[model samples]
Target: MRLIEKVWFRGHPAKWLLVPLLLPLTLLFYFISALRRALFTVGLKKSVTLTAPVIVVGNIGIGGNGKTPMVIYLVELTRQLGFKPGVISRGYGGNAPHYPYLLKEDTSANIAGDEPVLIHQRCQVPVAVGSNRIASAQLLIEQGCNVIISDDGLQHYRLARALELIVVDAKRLFGNGFLLPAGPLREGRWRLNKSDLVIFNGSPNTELWPRKLTTPNAIMQLTAKVVCNIKTGERITLSTFVQNNPQVNAIAGIGDPQRFFDTLSAQQLCLNNTQSFVDHHAFCLDDFSHFNDNIPLLMTEKDAVKCYGFSQAHWWYLPVDTRFSAIEQQKITELLITKLAV
Candidate 1:
C-alpha cells in the first residue's frame, strides 16, 4: 500500500496505461459524490439534526489531516466555555456491533477504531462510534452532552451539522486536485468554498484558499505540546530526547509518518532505524522485534492505542497539543456559545 501511494504520488509510468480506465471511474465517483450532496441541498434527502449544534471536523482528501488533535482542541475549547462537548465517529476500521457504543480505554481499536479510542483516552469526555453518526450523537446527548463534535464527517451529509471545519494538510494540499482514482480528493477543490472553516494543519500556504472558519470563525495554529514514555510514563521534551538519546528507533503508523519523523529530526534526533506502518496499524510483538531494549522506540499517541498492552520498557509516545491564536480561540468560543443559545 505504501508503494502504491509512493508510485501514485510520484506519477509512476504504470498509471499512464491505466488512466484510460481510471478516468471514467474517477468521473463516476465525482458525479456520485456531487449527486449525493445535491440531494441533501435540495431537500430531496433529509439530514438528521440535533437539539444542540454539531461541529464536524473532516477533510475532502483521504488520510489524516491532524483531525484527532483538532478534535481534542475543540473539546478543551468548549469545556472552557462551560459547554459539555461529546464526540462521534464512524469507527472507520472498527468491527463493533454497529450500534452506538460509548468508548473506554479498554475498548479495542478493532471495535472503536484507533482515532476514537485515542480521543476517548485524551479528552476524558463522552465518545461514541458507530456507522450511523446521527445515532451516536443522540446517545451522547442522552448522556447529557450539549455539544457534539463529529470526527471526519465532512462528507457524511446525512448527519446535519451547524458548523463545518475542513482540515487540510498544508504540505499536501489537495494532492493534484483531482477526484479519487485520479488523485486523492473525495470532493473537488471548489467544494471547499462551502465549508464553514478551513484549517491548515502545518504551516500556512498561499497556494490554497486562505485559512478561516465561516460563521464567527478564526484561524488556529498547531504545535507539539509534549512527548512521554509509553512504558515508563515519564515526560521528556523533544529537545532533551534528541540531545541525550543513545541510538533510537522511530515508528509512526499515522497518515503522514514523515511529518512525525521530521519533527524528531528538527530536535536533532537522527533515528538509527525508522519503520512506517499503515495508518492505524495494530501493533504486535513482532512489529517491535526489530529493535531491542538498547534502542528507544518512539511513536505517536494515535499509534499508542494499539500499543497499550505493550510492556517493552524502551517504548515512548509523544502527545501533541494544538493551540489556536488568541483571536481565533475567542471566535470559536463565541461561536459555540451562540450555537448553544440557539
Candidate 2:
C-alpha cells in the first residue's frame, strides 16, 4: 500500500496521528475550492450547457464507490426509456495525445483510461475522455447521443448538469468528514444537499450517512458470480470453482481492494493468497514472474483490461453487476422523465 493511503485508511488513533499536521492544509484547500465554486455560481466563470440534458454520476469523496457500475446501469436504464446515452470521463490516468479521445473496445487503458474503456466494453455506448469535459460531451452529442452521462464530474463546475447523482461508499461514508489532506471528502458535507439523488454502493448505515442529505436515496448491491479466463474467454461459476476446490490466488488493483476480497470470501471461494496494487497500477509480466503457472489467478474485471496481451490461460477475472429494486428502478425512470420534460 502507498504510505499516504495507509495513513488515510488506517482508522482510529493511528489515522488521527496525521490530522494535526494535515488540518491547516485542508483548510486552505477548502477555501480555494469554495472560491472556485463561487466564481462559477456568480457567472464570473461560465458553465457550458449542452443541447441535451446531462446527468453527472459522481462522488463527494475521493475513492471509487461503484460509480462506473452505476454509470453503466444508467446507460442501460436511459436506453430502456428510449434515450441514446453517451459517457464522458476525465480520463485521469490516461496519457492520450490530445483531448476528446473517443474510446474503442481495443483502446489501451494506457491511452484512454481504465474506467472509460471498461464502460465502452460493457455498456456498448459512445464514450469519450478529456480534461475538458465540455469538449468530450460535444463529441458525444455529435455522435447522436440525446443524453450525456458525465461519469465523475461533480467537481467540474464548468459543465452544467441537469441532475447531479452522488454515489457513496456505504462502509466509509465520507471518512471522518474532513476535506482534502485531513479527510477523504472533496467537498463539504453540506454539498450533499445540492445533489438530486444519493445512492449507497452497499448497505446504508444511517448512523454513518451525512445528516445534511435530504435528497431521495437508494441502495445498490454489486454481485460477482462468474469468473472468465482472460486469454480464451471461458467462464466458470463460483459454484464450479468451489466444487473443484483448487488453490486460487486473488489479485485486485482497485480503489478498495478489500471489498473485492470480501466478496470472494462471501461466495465460499478459498483464497490461498491475495495481492493488491495501487489503483490503476500498470501491469507487466515481471509482476507475475514469481507465481506458479498451474495455480489459478483471480482478478477483478477492471484489472483484467490492463493485463490482456500478457495474460496467462490460468488467469481469470470476475465481472460485477449492480442490482436495484424494482421500485427504485421505476422511481429513477420517472425522475429522469420528469427532469427531461422540463
Candidate 3:
C-alpha cells in the first residue's frame, strides 16, 4: 500500500506501469465529476437549502486532511459565539441500523464511524450520521441547533452550503495531481479557489502553499492535549507521559499514521516499535497480542474510541486538538463570523 501510495505522492517506477493502466479510469472519473457539478450548476439537480446556516468542511482529495479536527474546532468556536452548532457526517465505514442516527451515550464507533463518535464524545454536541446529508442535518436542526457543520461533503452539491472550508494535508498536497486511480484526488486543484477558506494541516505557515490555491487560507497545527488511560479513565498531561523516556509502542489507523508517530517522536518518547493500520481499521483484542504488557501502548484518540471496549490496562490514547497561530486564528475567526453572518 505504501509503495502504491508513493506512486501518487512521490516519484515511483511503479507510476510508469500504473499510470498507463490508470489513466483511462482517471479520465472517466474526471468526466463523471465534471458532469456531476455541471448538473448542479445548471439547476438540473436540486440542492436542499436548510433553515440553519450550513458550513461544509472537506478536502479535494481522499484520506484525512484534518477535517474532523476542523469540525471539532468550529463546534467549540461557534459555541463561544453563542451559536448552537450541530454536526452531520456521511459515516463512511459505519452501518447504522437507521438513517440520520443521532449519537447517544451507548453509540459505538462501529455504528457512528470513528470520527463522529469521537466528535460527539469530545465536544458533547448533537451529531447525526447518515448517507443523506440533508436528512442528517435536519436532525441536528430539530435538536435546536442554529448552525450545521458537515464533516466532509464539499462534493455533495445536493446540499446547499452557506460556507465552505477545505482542509489540505500540507505535506501531501494533491498527490500526483490526478483524480482517482492515477493519483490520490477526488477533484482537481481548481476547486480550492471556490472554497471560502483552505486549511493546511501539519502546517502553520500559510506562505508555503502554491499559487493555485488562491482562496483565503490558514495553517492548522494538531497539538497533543491529554493522555488518558483507556481502561482506567485516568488522565494526565501529554508532557507528563513522556517524562524520563517512557517505553511506548505507537499504533495508528489513520490516514497518515506516520504523522502520529512523528508527533510522538517529537515528544521524546522512546518507542519500542510502531504499527500502522489501514485508516479506520476495526480494533479487536487480538490485534495487540504481540505487545509486551510491561510497555505502554499509545494510540490516537480516533483509535481510542474503537479500542475502549476491550482495551488493556497498559493501553493509553492521546487526544489532539487543532490550533493556529494568534494572527491566523483571528483571521479564521473573523472569516467565519463574516461568512456565517451572511
Candidate 4:
C-alpha cells in the first residue's frame, strides 16, 4: 500500500510520522475548497447552469466506490423514462486528441479514459470527456442530449447541477474522516447532507453513517454472473467458466481491488493467484508479460476497456450490473422524475 493510503486507511506508526507533514497541506486544501464553494455560493464567482439539467453522480472520498456503475445505472434509468441522457466526466488519466471529445464506438479508452468508455459501451449513450465540464456538457447539448449525468464532479462548483447523488464505499466510510491529503475525502462528511440522495455501495453497516443529517439514502449492490473473453466476444456463465477453468488468475486495477477479488471468490471462482494495481492504471501489454499465459486471466470490465486491443485468448473480464431493490429503484425513479421533471 502507498504511504498516503496507509496514513488515510490504516492505523500504522508510519502514519504518525507522515500525518503531521500532510496536515498542513490538508488544511490548505480544505480552506481552498471551502473558499471556492463559498465564492460560487455567494455569486462572487460565476457557475454555469446548463440548458439541460445535470444530475451529478459522485462521491466524497477519492478512489472508485462504484461511481461509474451508478452512472451507468442512471443512464439506463433515464432512457427508460424517455429522456436522452448524456454523460460528462473529468476523464482523469486520459488526454484526448482534442477538448470536448465525444466518444464514438471506435473511441479508445486510452483517449477518453476507461470509465467513460465503459459507460458508453454499456449504455450506448453519448459521453463527453474533458477537464472543462461546461464545454463537455455543452457538446452533449449540441448532440441533442436533454439531460446530463456527470460522472464524478461533485466538487466542481462551476457546473451547476439539478440533483446530486453520492456513492459511498460502505466498507471504508471516509478513512480518517479528514479532507484530501490527510484522508480520502475530496469533500467532508457534511457534504453528504447537501446531496439529493446518498447511495451506499455494498452492504451498509448503518452505524457508520454520520449521525443526524437526513439526506435520504439507499443501497446499491453489484451482481456479476457472466464472464466474457476479451479477444473474442464469447460469453459464458461465471459458474460454467469456473467449472471449466479452476486455475484462474484474478487481476484488478480499481479503487478496491480486494472487493473485486472477493466478489469473484464469493461467486465460486477458485483463484490460483491475484494481483492488484492502482486505480485507473493505463494498462499496456508489457504489464502482463511477466504473467503465465497458460493460466486463465480474469479482470473487471473496467480494465477490459483498455485491454481490448492486445487481449490474449486466455484473458476474460467479468461485467457487473447495479442491483437495487424494488423500493429503492422506485424511489430513484420518482426522484429523477420529480427532480428533473422529465
Highest lDDT scorer: 4
Model 4 lDDT tens row, 107-174: 98889999999999989999999999999999999999999999999988889999999999888778
lDDT of 4 at 220: 93
| TM-score of each prediction | 0.92, 0.96, 0.96, 0.97
What stretches of model 4 exceed 4 Å from their correct place? none
Residue 113, candidate 1: alpha-carbon lDDT:
89
The global C-alpha lDDT for each of the candidates, from Candidate 1 onward, is 0.80, 0.86, 0.89, 0.90
Ordered by TM-score, highest first, the candidates read: 4, 3, 2, 1
Q: Mark the 10 consecutive residues where model 1 has the least summed lDDT.
A: 210-219
Q: In candidate 2, which residue ranges exceed 4 Å CA deviation?
A: 12-16, 209-212
What stretches of model 3 exceed 4 Å from their correct place? Answer: 1-3, 204-211
How well does model 3 score by local distance difference test?
0.89
Q: Write the per-residue lDDT of candidate 1 for residues 1-342, one digit (tens) a residue.
A: 464455445566666565555788899998898898889999999998788789999888888688888899989988887889999998877888658988875787888989998898888899999888999999999999999999988888888888888888787676655688777788877667787777777665554554442333345555665668777778877777766785678899888798888887776777889989988787788888868668888888888777778657788887888877787777766766665564
Candidate 4 local Cα displacement, residue 34, angstroms:
1.0
Stretches > 4 Å off in candidate 1: 209-220, 340-342
Tens-place lDDT per residue, model 2, 1-342, is 665566666565656578888999999999999999999988999999899899999998886689999999999988988999999998877988888999876788899888888899888899999989999999999999999999999999999999888998887677677888888889977777789888988887767643656888889999777779999989888689767755788888898898888988888778888888888888898988777787888888888888897999889888999898999888888888888773
